[model samples]
Target chain A: MDDQQKWRLELQNSNVEIRATAAENLCLAGSDSVAAAVDLVVACGDVEDVQNWAAAALEDIGAPPVDSVDALESLVSSSDPLVSYWAVTLLGRLGVDASRSQVILGKAVSDSPHPSVQERAAWALGKIGATEASVVESLKKAAASDSPRLANLASRALA
Target chain B: MFWLIVALLTGGGVSGLLNPDWPIVGPLVTSVKTQAIEYKNQNPLGLVGGDAGHESANTAGAYAGPPVQSASALGPNDKILMATFNIQVFGESKLRKPEAMAVIVEVIRKFDVIAIQEVRAKADDILPRLIAELNADGSRYDFIIGPRLGRSVSKEQYAFVYDTNRIELDSASVGTIGDPADLLHRAPFIARFRPRTTDPDRAFTFWLVNTHTDPDDVPEEVNALAQVFQVMQTARPDEDDVILLGDLNANEQQLGDIRKIPGVQWVVGGGVMTNTRQNKAYDNIIFCAPATQEFTGKWNVLNFEQEFNLSREEALRVSDHFPVWAEFDVWESSGAVH
Candidate 1:
């Protein structure tokens, strides 16, 4: 099998070490490695340890995986906090072009059960820099939230 | 580990260990190796220009006695140095890097008081270790750390480390802001301090509100800070001199509502960058003007890279943020105090 197929197989392996190793190796592949990016998005949905390594790999990639935006968008709602955290952060890292995900990010900011998830969603919205009225209203609502973490993030985004 | 030892031996001895260009030895090992190197370099004789360099010597003919009238001519005892530093995450990540601690200690020793931020809840050992290190030279240094605070589950503590000989802490006045409005992520901690001085005319007390605002929440937090400031003032009705210092995370222009607070002066200004990366002015020392005229106009952003002769990355490994400081005379003055 090719390097991509080898990594993909490792990602699917039952052993956590094998999956983590594959994710880390894929991260080392850097931003141009679309294959690594694709596999990392798949791994982002895996168990927490595997998911963390995969998300870190995606972060190391430092650019949005053009092919993985849809997958990331879906992962933003994952029950796992780590998965949602990485997904929102990744979306933010994608910048203004990822504006299409603003609605979901705004909802995550307002209603996500986890404080970290809400914080990241607010950060992602700020990163997207959407000036739309709905986006502003959502941030305003979040800015007034009782949680200082969420409020601070929403205030920053609005600023 | 072997390569790190070799690098330390060949590159300027102990100081070279903090060189950012040193080959990556993985994050965990790097912290361990850096600490081991610093431990090896520790000297009892006191290395050249350690604490001694900070001393101010009077000119041969100048008056050396107390009650030095001019603020410019004030000696170290007649002046108090204060600093604000975001030591990144001062926990296990920094614990193993003794070289960084050495730099941190050296920077802090130059000041009478320092407000430190980003102290992790899990790493309570770091402060005791730091205090022990600072007191090793027979200097009496103590710290008051606030409870673990943050809006999120992940939390950090704020602390004030001061030289006992130069300042006295009002134990009763120590408390964190109770944010009923829920405006700030981490409510600032207020500590009242009275400068130790024999000259009763010069004795003055001030409240220090140590804070580390979230970068994302600068506008709102900065605005809300005015409320925190007002509450602190109300708590200590007699003290009008209140100084806000820490990683404000906002520049002067971005101060939002904080800028509107009348008579407030941001001492560190002109777009000076305080981060090791040289991109942001994330730290500040702001005080209520006219009330705090003891300010000596001397301010600095301690650049660890330039001071330690280390590479930028090495400095960052110590801390991404640099310490910003301002000097103040122990004596209160009326017009044009330095």
Candidate 2:
């Protein structure tokens, strides 16, 4: 197997140290080996550190294939909420497309009851220029959510 | 021996059959008898063990969500079809071609008139190139790119596109009339079109405006829409059909604020993609007088993704949202256009 393949297998290794190290290295090479790395990390499933590292790598790749909407959408159904957040955050950062942003952001807002997840979705929607009225209302609601900090974030999003 | 068999049947065999404790008796009985309680008790979540990917799934009477989409209200009405999708600032880093274009194409396969929003500037950009590519690929469509002006730090707006012969756009402008600067979107696209139909009066004028409002200034988006009427009152002449299309961030419920200006009839927009989780109407095609009553049309959302069960990955690849298409037939009243 290739060196990258070896690293990916290492991610599933029982040792946390080995897995974390391997994930970081794969991220470093994402621009070169994105397809393999993306597949492996996503398949890694619930490993929080590994999934996040993979998201970071994909975000770094940044254009063309990175501009790929299917890749982001795949992460929407991710078992880990953090991984899903990372996907939405990265998609927002990449500016995937204004049209698709609404749908994906809509998913993030609806599916994720976690307040933090909702907060991230609200920000992404604003960045995406969400023309939808509900997004507008949700942003307004989120801006006023129970948490003081998130409320502040929500208010800013209203702007 | 017959007495021995009768004794076995009465005392031993009958008791074993009635209670059925195969585990204790077992080895011999399992081979002979089938419906064993012991077997049923063994794999209870298929709680019958071994093979994985089970559990939680055993919760049969659990909450199954609502039914998926019923069926598309827009199931093949006419031979010719047309659709418009403004992918919001094409040729930008954020735009995912796979997701956005897939959804847009899925919705707009047949429609003849497609008015786009936030097209690439005439300056050095790939958006114009992309438009050219679309034109080259399709036979039915020959795109007419119109007056360009910058909408924000990034986008220089685009408001028009069409098939060459079938719908001849006599003139296309950013604003309804006069200097383009008067209208927001640098001038909402005002196109004069002649629909080729059998009847003479059917040769009426139609106006299409594809626009994306200022996300920062909600008021600007609102005011820009209000100005659309001013264009109709003057530039479009006394009697003409006007159909304003685009991502009007304002909801249909709030559309009254926009319609208050005059001449605009606010015809069919209840069925547009609101982009919200809740089914609130957002995108629009507010119409002028004659176009308003143009046969009292259907206000469709054009969201085919719900009916066509594409996996989430595949659907997002089309676009974040489905294209919105509205259909209307022409009708005149009191010798004047409705």
Candidate 3:
């Protein structure tokens, strides 16, 4: 495999530092890094260093491929806060293309224990701008939440 | 007209014109007030917040139905508004939105010097464009941006945008704090500033360490910041008014060891939330209460959503974090004047 492919595989390496270095390298590769976006997103659940680089790489790429949408949607419910956060972040970056993930994102907003995840999910819903009744209903309920950040974002989505 | 006054106050000669790259030091004092533009013509949609249609809106520009005050009219050299705002992902996308850009400009025009974080862009147009819009009202403003920093490829930069007519940036003092131990996600961007004053020695010269910590690594980053604050304390023998501010990602009680600094105080207390959601206080302006006695005991979190009467989504388009500000005296309280 080519060096870029090798680095993409390194994201699944056993050593956290090696994985982090790989992610950082791919991130610096610019648009050439888009091919590694999915691996980078998966690595976001790793150690803090690795997760940070992976998340940054993913964010720098702007959006992952549409084929990775299902994987990202499932990861949004990951128990780890960072995992769910990055998942929602990437899905949100997908904008309207990730419309299919709204139900999961809505569930994250309404039921996720992590406030950050909930906040991102709420923000994602607004970015998606899906008019589904369930999506609208979830945002409406969240608008009255005690958490001002969540309520603010949900209200913004409704608007 | 504002640039002329800026030339006098900052010693930045009028020959420098309005270039963002022009050095902002030197003195030329003129009382020419900025010519007021009729908002009715420029803001056709009335989204700029101060015309007849939005009279009741509580925006940063028109917080209480106040008239559209010229940037020169904020007061000469009596007091200055210092603020911190994390313009969420400020880059090309946000720049494309004129309405969002207008709100951003309005909020910034209200402060003398605003520390901006989350400037994520590969190109360098963000700050220059912002400066252009700010000066669109004939106000003289300039910006100093640090190198892009972070552990990942999507690095972010820290910037300080100041109204040259009211504040003077010590360009020589601008640099990022050294972090050999790698304690912060983004090393703080440090710079010094002084207000426009008749007595140069009495100007309240102080250092600002602008930072945005990693959300996932709060406790550790905050603890390191405490050290950074202490280092700043001894960095300069003459300056003790070090106001460290930005999107710290932690509230008052959660600031970890930074609280251990003797007499260190933050302007935005537990009662105020900095995030747009209004539920979390993720940003603040911190200082040594004893050293910076110039603080006027006034502070606020400018809620653009409520002030501009924008939907939460539109507000988020401007930023997820609201601008937090604290007022301070233009002249040094404990300096040569005393």
Candidate 4:
């Protein structure tokens, strides 16, 4: 119907390049295209390439959609580490403004199976600066993690 | 009245003013000394090894051992203690561990000035709580916390906390390095401090460039740190004493670009591991040996596990990294004792 709607359709297209191009175009649209990019990322499901591209587009957008925090939170809790990584990274970029996602990020710090996902989650929690007792406890556990990378990241967040 | 006049006439007035035992000055000096002694007694270093009123009663099993001296007690009178600690994310998580907090306080109390790294953005409550705990025993301390810094989405803050009675921060001299090339992930934070000693001749000042390099970008940031140190040294030609301290994330063998600087010395060398895990020498207290002539050659890692009698797991909970410290004389120039 409109240019943004046209790009959203391309995002659903079976073509990989088309989806990437659509994601890039949405990024170029900046803050105006946040809702569509968020929708693309959420609806794209387990499509790693499309989700990754859309996540990067959201990162480029630089601002979180006011209503998209729930979708991003759901994405962060994804069992897939890549999806969790990209989503948590995007939340980190959003900073304290994404306060609603702090608890899930804190949980992911200690619970996430992948080190990178756990690291990103710890980083996001630090960015959020959440003061909850549970959040602090989760980070403390992660700080003593056997994995040096995860421990270092958790330590940085605790520091 | 006659004695007072005679005392004033013979330049005794000046001597009397400086004398700690003089009737007018005696009470104030005694009061300060009393306070220091009281603080030391209340928060004894050996308290960590005992069943004190610590919050970690359940988790931290009782420590039974001889009272070991604190790192602060080992320094010579003429020298001030300076330390750099990578406090592992120093935020809400650390606050949640009260046993860890107690051990941290004991280690920190051993230094007059400490440069803290990895302060998370938005965790402003940690420092105030620490200061409150430190001052509960009557020790006065103040801090200079910098703005959020880093090259990533998750930024951090650098802070300098000093004993107000021993050191005075040069408020105007606090700033972070500006990296136009973006070589460093987090620009080093610089601050100047003067020893709060009455002997003007012995009162000296120095600059501290505090930093924590990205682990992945250690080699480049380490080299860039040398450049930053050089620039900071030249920026303040009047102040020859400059110390760079933090979690370099690289040992002496890996200090690629930093070792190239002339007169530079790594006080904490590769032989010493400054981490609680005993795996890495991530923290360091570095300075130009020739320029900082006041170095007393006294330094050590604050091993909480051994010193505080903490279990390996409990110790790691405090911080995977240990504090590394060095002692430096208060005098800027070599001179006969007054």
The DockQ values of the predictions, listed in order, are 0.13, 0.02, 0.03, 0.03
Categorize the docking of model 1.
Answer: incorrect
Sorted by lDDT (best first), the order is 3, 1, 4, 2
Q: Candidate 2 vs candidate 3: which has greater lDDT?
A: 3
Per-residue C-alpha lDDT of model 1 across residues B1-338, encoded as one tens digit per residue: 22223334433323111222233232111111122232223222332113431222121111111221223212376788888998865765456678878898877787788999988635445576777788788665666677777654446778888876576554434556666545676888767665666653346667798999865457778887876665544443356777899988787778776677778888777878988878788799987777788888888999989999988656866776899988887766654321
TM-score of chain A of 1: 0.82
* CA RMSD, predictions in order: 14.5, 30.6, 18.9, 19.9
- Who is ahead in DockQ, 1 or 2? 1
TM-scores of the models, in the given order?
Answer: 0.66, 0.46, 0.58, 0.56
In model 3 chain B, the worst 10-residue window by lDDT is: B26-35
* Candidate 4 residue pairs in backbone clash: A155-B88, A155-B89, A156-B89, A157-B89, A158-B89, A158-B90, A158-B91, A159-B88, A159-B89, A159-B90
Q: Is candidate 1 or candidate 3 better by lDDT?
A: 3
lDDT per residue as tens, model 4, B208-322? 9899986645776788888777765655335677899998988888888679889889887858998876867888988888788888898999898999888876775676688
Candidate 1, residue B246: the lDDT equals: 94
Write candidate 3's Cα lDDT for B1-338 as tens digits. 22223323433322111222222221211111111121112223322332352233222110112222333676555889999998876776567779989999999998999999988766666677777788788776767677778754456888888876667654335557666545576888877777755554566878898999976457868998998888877654567788999999889989998899999999888578897767789899999988899899999999999989999767866887899999999888864322
Instruction: Give candidate 4 regions above 4 Å deviation.
Output: A1-159, B1-75, B335-338
Candidates 1 and 4 compared: the better one by DockQ is: 1
**Model 3 complex DockQ against the native:** 0.03
Q: Model 2 Cα displacement at A47 (Å)?
A: 34
